[model samples]
Target: MSAITLGAVRPRFRPRRISPARWGLYAFILITALYFLLPLYVMIVTSLKPMAEIRQGHLLALPASPSLAAWVKAWTSACTGLTCEGIRTGFFNSLRILLPSVVISIVVGSLTGYALSLWRVRGANILFGAMMIVAFIPYQVFIYPLVRVFSFTGLGQSLATIVTIHTIFGLPTMTLLFRNYFASLPVELFKAARIDGAGFYQIYARIMMPMATPMIVVAVILQTTGIWNDFILGLVFAGRDNLPMTVQLNNIVNSTQGERAYNVDMAATLLTALLPLVIYFGSGRWFVRGIAAGAVKG
Candidate 1:
């Protein structure tokens, strides 16, 4: 009989089975997703339902007869004041404010963040701490003071004034974002640039800015959302001619007289919200990465 020698046998690879904990996690995620999506579902279906069907009081049910009339009315013929010109005017006005405000705020914030992170200037810490404290204070508290200051400067209730207001309010948060992101970078890079005789602007323009693509996207998303959806600030600062879509949306929905067109109201609300939703979704990947990078060190 041949002697059978015990030899090493490699274990076959087997796929791991899902644990109960993982299944529970999946269930929890599905529940949370449904919760968040509930409102959006309601808004969409409500917008599609006609005034007749809506009057039947079947809110949760799918529209028996879907119609695009509400969307058409909200976009082209909704009355806000004597003008029946829909939300188009306000849309253009918002774009004018949004473009300039986003550009100026991001530029100023990036510079401020860069200085605070890289330079050890006198009173920098005190200034940054003061800014942080200001951020915690409600924006409503600044309205009166800001109005007074704007009136004193003769910039009251105009495009420029609104843009300035957005910039001012956006600064602290933006600075903190970029500052933390910069702080997470390698110190060696700065030292190497310094060894090459690069000054502040040179180092920033060539090195820092180039490496800050993700954070810039993040800043854009934040400023766009806040500045776009701002009803109070726009109403206060964006003069009559410059009223944003949100203000127009409010006028359409909050009328005290005449039959309330719920369908049109919902459509207008969704349309006003579409811009921010687009920005959020478009920059979703960058937003996550930027936030992660910013939060890494500080």
Candidate 2:
């Protein structure tokens, strides 16, 4: 003790240890994650299960023998009505409705938002406010009037009509999304472009649009998911010849007299989901970056 052990007292070294509250927060996060993921887990497991096992009600249980036969039958031979044609018949129809609507909606919405955000055109604010207000209205309120208009205009129940309908319905939300996004951007960006002799279209197409990649991805996601998942609007306007997969799916799942094929039904659901799924998975990385880039702000 007399050896002057002050050297041992040198700043009691302590490692950075996590506090108990942090550990509890991590535990809470894990539980929340599991809660949200439960349904997805059930769907995957159930989809892999055969009808015999599915009927047994242990939907979460591992498949007795995993097979892709349901997926195959769903693609080529599962019945929808009087025919054995599967949901593949309507995949292209969905695309037909999706592409034109997406392109037209994005182009028009972006232009409208850019104008509303940056320009000082007369009555523009009024129009923008009206659009935003109407965006919150349930779409059903407009369907009857729209149908009457479409009928009078001789565009009733056609691909063109559906595309136009999607464009119209998508406008309010699309405009709001881009307007808010563009508003958050620095005004200096537009002014610098203007000083460099950039005109309206020039600034939009060059300086603004390039930086708008994130918002564009968001728009694509929303429009793609909506148009692809659409059943009601497509049913009303997509004509018998152009029925999307959802309509086919409804028929398959609901036909009272038809023998219910659960396997095919699951596969068809998966197929119908493919478009939106592809968009999400493909652009997920950009979506993250774009959000981080301040596409949506407080």
- Which candidate tops TM-score? 1
lDDT string, candidate 1, 1-298, tens digits: 0111112244787448888887898899999999999888888899999998889868788988788899889889888867888887888999999999999999899999999998888998898888887887877888988899998999888999999999998888789888877888998999899999999999999999999987788788778887899999999988999999999889877862678888888888899999988876887666455444333323
Candidate 2: list runs displaced more than 4 Å: 1-35, 55-57, 195-197, 256-259, 285-298
Q: Can you write out model 2's per-residue Cα lDDT over 1-298, one digit (the tens) per residue?
A: 1121223455876548888987898899999999998866765666677788887768568788888778788778777667777778788889889999999999999999999999878998899888877777887898999989999999888999999999998888788778877888999888888899889999989877899887888788778887899999999999988899898878766772645667667777888887777877787655444333332221
Leading candidate by lDDT: 1
Clashes within 3 Å, all models in order: 0, 0
* Model 2 global lDDT (CA atoms, 0 to 1): 0.80
| Prediction 1 global C-alpha lDDT | 0.84
